[model samples]
Target chain A: MISGPIPPHPRALLQDLWLEPEATGLAEARPSLKVSSSAKKKDADPTTRGPKAKASQGDLREDDPRERPPYQGNLDSEVFHLESGWKLLASDLCFGKGLDVDFLGMDANRTPIAVLALGEEDQDLCPLKLLDLKAWFQRNKELIRQTWMRICPELISLDLCRDLRFFLIAHEFSPSLIERLSCLSSFDLLLFRLRSLGVRGQQYWYAEGVAPWAHHSQEVSPFEAPSGVEAELLRERINTFLSRVQVVGEGLVGRSLDFEGDRFDRRALIENELVLELGVDQGQVWIRIPGIPDEFLLGTDEEQSRVLDCFLRSLMARNHPTWGSVPLGNSPRKPEQTQNEGKALGGRPEPQPREDRLSSSEPEKDSPWGRGNPCRSSKHAERSEGTRLSDEEMAAFFGS
Target chain B: MAKFFDRIFKPFQRHVALPSSLVPPVVGIASGKGGTGKSMVTVNLGVLLGSPRARVRILDADLGLGNAHLPLGLKPDRNLQYFFEEKGSLADLLQHSRYGVDVLPGGSGLSRLAHLNPSDFRRFALGLDSVLEGAAAVLVDSAAGISPQTLSFLLASDLVLIVTTPEITSLTDAYALIKCLALRRPGRGVSLLVNQCDDSQQGWRAFEKIRDISGRFLGIHVSFLGAVPGDPAVRSALAARTPIVIRTPSAPAARGLRACARRLEDILEEIPQWRKVPSYGRRLLEAQR
Candidate 1:
């Protein structure tokens, strides 16, 4: 990762790679494989079109299950679920998933570390929650700091947080949740916090009566402003989001400060509400609030992304425990019993047929997927959509 | 299961699917004056070279007046004016000729397109990319006289094929076009095709006069691409609303056009890496943006 400015030609160079014979050949080859696979599977199963065969495929049966199938293992019963940090954020806070998130999983550095699958299936109504999240972070402050130091040795030159990631507040949440998480040493360098929230329900239908943003709106209804409790909650969420962003630290400040060259009067600096003039001083990023006469040296875009990543990890470790705060330390519940009681009951769990899966599984590959008619094949479309959405989230975070 | 079955079986519907080849090379037929048979050459040339796989898209770029389709005895469903009508993409305006060629009928509205500002130009280019992506070539039949819009079309193209008859007036006008283009782009390619030439000697004389003068004075290389014989079959084909190539395959004009197209193809193959350079006027706008 050299730090000089990226040449404009690099965009064209990347385009060339996508168009190269090897790349195009691979793209063409994929559909052929899928076409053959379906043909083969059809040939192998004489009753492939029968109801029994469809049942055996388990698409419907799996959809009906009210539990976090066996693999999830009473994560609801856990004392600390890493996903609580996410729940603490406003429900409407807009977060998009890119391709990488589904692949290289997010890490929470506690002893029995956990990974949350904010995968496509669970993304719409994320059920994971944090338990004793606040106390745990306060107790393990040193470990959290050490973890970030080890993971990101050169966090000074990164800028992933600014360009690739942002949170649009959905609704306000408990102050304790926002305050405890925001208090972390990291989570700085966040720019462009859009305050408005547009909410819609399932009744909203477009072509063919299908809800495009089904995950966010439960059903696809036309976009409308949030109201009543949702509106109030959204306002608080915006406040907290803005408050958490204003907490300036060494790494976050480093991202905004232009220290490449020149020097100026530090005290003469004035923060015009919308714009902040930042410059570097003695290899440090200084912060000046709107009313204050000081300048902050926030590092570049790359540095800011790395610091935010650290904050997310620490927050995940303290907050998320099990299915809705059932700390992982608790005794496991019977699978059948939990199946009858879990909240993943109502609302569609599976993605719609023919929707692109690459948007979920491997988001880094998002650009190429949208270019042509490659998604015409239902098989490729379904598989790509199911897997790609998670990868998109991760890619968004890293690339975000 | 029924839904899955339909999805899996859908692609098999096409009985004779052919791999799509690149679009036909767009050869814009332009000249320095009217009645030079620019439209006649473009129509007949397109008909002469068009194949089932390599489809020709003859764009009538003439502003206010266009006769490429009429001379060829065809009427398009929607002319080039529809391309700028804000309602449709270029894809919707494409009309296929009976002879297996696609024609973008030019209209007076084209002048407005020529005056598009920077943002409009970028949007226009993206639409053009979709239109040009599949065509082997786009033959822009530019209006007679080098107007600003006509110059834009000429400079934007990969090859500027200038058509002129054997008369002294035609030769001088053709030479003037070469001189104008030479002053602007001293190193660019300019092909000369003698349309309505009574004989090979006259055609060669016209080509030589233009080529020699441009080379000596302007230091420009004006190539003699090929010459079309002034044959009665071309007039009869126009009267019948059919291309000479389709009406009489052995016609001297048809034969000459095919040869010219082949030579143009060979020249294109020589510079396989020569990318489609955007119009210089458009580039200037982009720089400002």
Candidate 2:
């Protein structure tokens, strides 16, 4: 995946993602994104590549962040730095040159994460900006991983380059944006809610996970949650194959067979290691072995059975003890095609009531329990023409 | 209890013929928790009420661990063991103290007495009429906890008094017992007597705690009879195998017991004619079914 070299200066690459021209003034300790000097030399002959960052970052960020720019006055971004099991590698770091991304950190898994905040208004190009930035990260993930590992020393694992997660912070999101984002399922976007307390000017802040979701690597019981509508659709799609899976799984004695949302997994009951997993994402069914990181897209029945059996026997033969830490792979997504690949995922949240849904003009809605009865709120009545009475009949009542 | 009544009402109602004269105010003393001086209160109340004008008999319905006789300073040659065996009668097993309080000794450590079947209850009630004869008031000392057997005895009585201490655990259990009684028979009010209190105020506070909760949640009245303050004389009297009231009349607990007895009399006076006249034996038999 490390096909091309990055720009001579990391800040220039960062400008392609998060360029804030108005935010030119310097502040105390605004850390820059660090890349090894060797990577800079190898990737960019900076003289030629300089124009691309200027074009994309400048064009995309023109309309955004007009209303509420990222944290003004006494507001600080320190709340994003989790205290335990996390390391803040670089703060306010730029990738290519002048483009400054927000805080950059590494999670417990040593996965490099880039964070960006969308302001309250003027966020029209957030989706496009994020998608393009994700493409940029994907193109240069190998360089970022290798260089960061050499400098940071803590990132020992080889699999750290598999994903570059993002934290896109905003007070709220629009529903259409959320739906559009859900259409592209591979991008790992875990939403978080931040609560601020204390006086207006000097506020204390804390962050909490808004949606209960599993990590990209489903080692921690994968639902890798899809909030509300998507969660329901995933459950429904997976349920369509539950009986068949159960039939196939019944013969396997020492396996922990279970289905959560769109993913069905079979692990050794003793080791709790992933043996086989089936899941659906945007109508694509992909399978992968725990020890083997390759997500094998399933084809025909004969091909699936052959590939699945071969992987199982291989897993049995090697039986790696560390396989328990491997992520769950899943559903028969659409025709095992390439449709799921390269599909961009970003903002798609509409502010919804967390409890009993309010009544709306929309025809019918699924009950909170998904398969339960449809909401039967009052419906609009049909109108009719008023009947006219004769003068004699009217006079009988009036005693005329 | 309803099912018990359903099964036995028709059968016993038709078979057993009864004279209406055996109705004295039946006061059942129960505590949801044990060791709150329930038996002591029963014995003291029995002694205070027992007289030539108004005779009182203590029914040791704490059948498994009956100690009413122990406090009354009486040893029974024949306890409920013989009665359950169908060898001796209930009235015959009744032993009287020097204070004129009659004591019915229940068999100690007898698991059979802990859970009485419908048939066993029927056999026991065979002698209830004789025991009730000429009695002005019958004080039933029921076993602690809301067991079906214990509940039958308590529900069958005209009045139920929950004897509890000032301790929170004791109050909670008392509340649980009151809740059970209120649910089983709504509007059938239960009285609470706080036993072994540090002071009168402590007892009153405990009573108010239970009364407020039971009245609010259960929608049934929990009457506070009175609080018996703890006194050293009460322990001495119990050790001497005599009720505190008889052993030391000036004792604080004895005085509180007397006051509660007076209150009991006033409450019993308002009892309906039907309640005073129900055949305790047949009702218990029905409840046991």
Candidate 3:
């Protein structure tokens, strides 16, 4: 400390004089001594390092750890613990009778589990391995209990036989193996895929349930997407209204609205003859009578009601004459009387000239039933042989 | 505890009373497996029971593969398909046969009604209500097997006739059908009719076997309706396009059918007059309402 340059301090002079060759020679001459010296250095100094030194010193890590080699085969036991809550209790557990388990572990529920790992090439032997695991567990239940107790003393009192579960872990499972394992619901199947990290012996392991994939192999129709709320509401309203109105001759007639198409035509028939045609297009109801030239569009309530009333009255009059005799709104005659009327209608030998009978009271030419009917005329009477009822006749029959 | 008590006491629950006007006996004819002549039995029975005094309406409820009209030599102008399409009333679908039986025909491919949604089914059932208004007895010929459509008809009927042959497969399937029915309706009684048997003894043996199995496994007693012997005349009458009971009244199968009809008539008479309710269709429609 007493000189022109302080003689460069003895430590600084020693550091500058020591070259790479001398350091190499010294390390070679005393390898153990040098290691022990470095170890001592690390232990003696607690807080005298740069940021990098402190960071490296805080955790004793190597760029690569020897224990974690690249998992070329099935995953190491620790990967399962990290991924699926499998705590390895023991590895290569053996009983005295030549029975051994690959790995013995505990699940998150503290249930003892036996796992067997198979490489892709050994996937065919899964069933054999499963059988072996089951046999080993059966043969060495007491040994497994003791081993579990030794590893986890807190769970020592757990029932090993009742709570034991078995799992098969493999690199890749064939579809056949998965199908076979799916049927064996007692065993859990885990499939692993290996991803190489930057390090030589390290990997990222992914595992999934193979049984679920096998169980859900059946083809299913995709769910139909729901119609929007407004469309559904409109449909519900239409259905409600249709349910209320009486569909005349509903069971005897064969007419349906083709809702999927742009236009639909339904021909209403009485006695196997088309009497009225109904068409629906662009939210409009079209009514067409056989002899009428104009198509009536039922757009409003009054129009719809009028058309429905006309259609029902025509049908009633064509099907039953007793409809005219029954008082308006009173329950139609008893079923027996209706049957009698039907019989009488069928048995009549000649058509009653109701127009002629009314002609004495009112001029026949002025009567719609005789001459002025829109649906029936002299030509139509000649063609239909008088089977068809005129609109005026139907009206007279309906007492309207 | 409440569930346990309910399980124990469920059988003791009283049946709700039904109105007398809605109580016409509905006889459902069914076969577990196809091609066992369920429709044949239904048609013959209808013909045997048909009269001015006894109004018999045969409803061919076989929505698919209905051939009830074939043996009658009459083509149906209208069928249940018309009812579903809302073109005709149920009354228009009613056809009168020369044999005095009223036939409500079912179409061959009219399977839409078989898969009807609840609302459409209700409407169809209401249509049935009007058709069944004046019927004294309605015999429903249900489609073969235990399909939901067939089961609905069977469940709604007052009496069920299970028709089967002496063949082993037929007997086995018939037992399966009976098992399903017994599981669903424990207290409902079923009658068995063995057809195509070589003789009365063979039919009786088959019936006994089924009765034993049903008693042991299902704990249900099956009533033995009379058996119809295998007769070449049945085939002959079928070839002639006529019901065996009508065309060949003296045939062996016809005699057996007459006996069965007589027995059914006796049973109907034995029922208390007050218990005679309206038709099943009417009751079903009323229930829906």
Candidate 4:
């Protein structure tokens, strides 16, 4: 079995290894191999649609916001399993080092099912990931059995599993990928087009059995990436999201605004008591909590997200007097006050209370921004003249 | 299984996929030697490029040994390890810094990603494109040096901004990296950034030195993309985990970073529509091969 590398011919680099005139001609010589009998049948059935036909639709783009499926959930819940006839043992099962499956459970036949879901962005690599996962599962059958038993401890003495089924869900499976699936005869491969249907303006994701005729598809709702425009969406989404989010806090350090940069630390009177400094410059929105010293950007991702939590609470409390009427701690809104229509946030809608609309907007006679703050100097009074925050914005700020 | 891995790990097609107009320009920040302030410059540029019209992302490509997250005062939950190990996706790992720019924090001090093979590059790069789903621009803060891994990244990008300090070794190494890229990809756009300069003249002189040599010997014109002067304010800002440009806009280095960012933006705009190109991962695999 001794072997050595062989030298290439001198003109190898100049040769076009990919394309050949002879190969193109050979296809014509063997027409049957190039064009299947199904192709000729297509002439008889003009209504038969292929991937190209489905893809040509103007609004069918995978990335188009209009084309997004209704439901945006993991589809591993009891509601989905009852609807789809599958049992989910776990979501996001991890291997010791590298490999992890998106889902693992059992089909109706008690046959173990492993699912790998990908989105339109990862459509190209869907087949490859499937192959990798299949290979891993085949090699580590005992590992799977061990984990399966661990999950279902009661199913101990009996033979835990026999046939393993792999399910792949994506927005759309390319024709080539389905064609490749034909060769993978040994594995019980189930391909589905991830789908969603709106139920009263709400999106609930489900799996649709993919057939040649079922060309339409979508991935399990991929969280849309946040862009500059999405930042505005975040503001709108946060308004509904933060309506109920509040903090039980006390003192806010009153600091003078540095009148240098493009943004000014303008005082916002939410009601008449609590004052919030908002950062809004040329349409960019951010919130600043002066009481919490977040001078440098020294904050973790968790702490920053807390800013979104305190957004409505801090913004709404801007005008409420801190000494008397201020809602500090859990004293502001009782759980009973929020018995109204749900306010939508991040797709999941929370009912908003009509009686308790976050806060009462009654104007105070001694409003700081509306009337002259007799307590402050004239310079401080003039600083609050212009309110830049159209609505309001904040960072992972208003740090608690 | 072998057949499947082969297809997955296969190199690029003989001809590139046609370059499309929608392709966002990915810029790589590289320095041949350490202590060239590449990460600092990358973070600042990311901050400067943040605007209403465009979204910017800084990819700390330093792998296991990265500190790009430190400057922004971010503690990311997941790093490159999480992505490579399939524990998390790129979006799950993104740390939205308080500065408005998103930071794709790199793995810190883990040898797992230090020796990535071609297949890994392919997987990582393909995933990198999804980050562009929201962002208009991505700045790859390449680790200091011309390692095969680093070079693969430099070649995958549309533009390479080589950051160098006034130190002789830094300049020499920067030239070395540029030369390597020039050889691998002839006439590849290489921009020069002279960091830690005493003044604009010193920065310009440093740029001139590298640009002249590369032009004379390599016969390639290297762009001098302005310079950031040495300032004590940079140190103060670093301590605060805030970029100097945001902290002290009047500082010399802040002004320089702003100018460089604007110049880079112009260069990005001037880029002629390329024929459709492969995804970043596919390009990475091609470069690795």
Candidate No. with top lDDT: 2
DockQ (C-alpha based) per candidate is 0.02, 0.01, 0.01, 0.03
| Model 3 residue B166 distance off true place after TM-score fit, in angstroms | 0.4
Residues B11-106, candidate 2: write the lDDT tens digits. Answer: 122112333464666899999899999999998777655542244778888788788889977878887878877786787888876554787788
What's the residue-level lDDT of B174 in candidate 4?
Answer: 82
What is candidate 3's lDDT per residue for A59-121, written digit by digit as tens? 223323334223322122211221122344444344432234445565434556665555444
Candidate 4 regions with alpha-carbon error over 4 angstroms: A1-400, B1-21, B272-275
Quote each prediction's TM-score.
0.37, 0.39, 0.38, 0.40
lDDT of 2: 0.54
- On the 0 to 100 scale, the lDDT of residue A196 in model 4 is 41
Q: Against the true structure, what is every candidate's RMSD?
A: 33.8, 36.5, 31.4, 26.3
Real interface contacts reproduced by model 4, as a fraction: 0.00
Worst 10-residue lDDT window for candidate 4 chain A reads A10-19
Candidate 2 displacement at residue B145 in angstroms? 0.6
Ranking by lDDT: 2, 4, 3, 1
Give the winner by lDDT: 1 or 2: 2
For candidate 4, the iRMS in Å is 27.4
lDDT of 4 by residue, A249-276 (tens): 2323122212111111122332222233
- Candidate 4, residues B6-52, lDDT tens digits: the string is 11111111012222224556789999999888888998887766532
Identify the runs in model 3 with alpha carbons over 4 angstroms from their true place: A1-400, B1-22, B276-279, B282-289
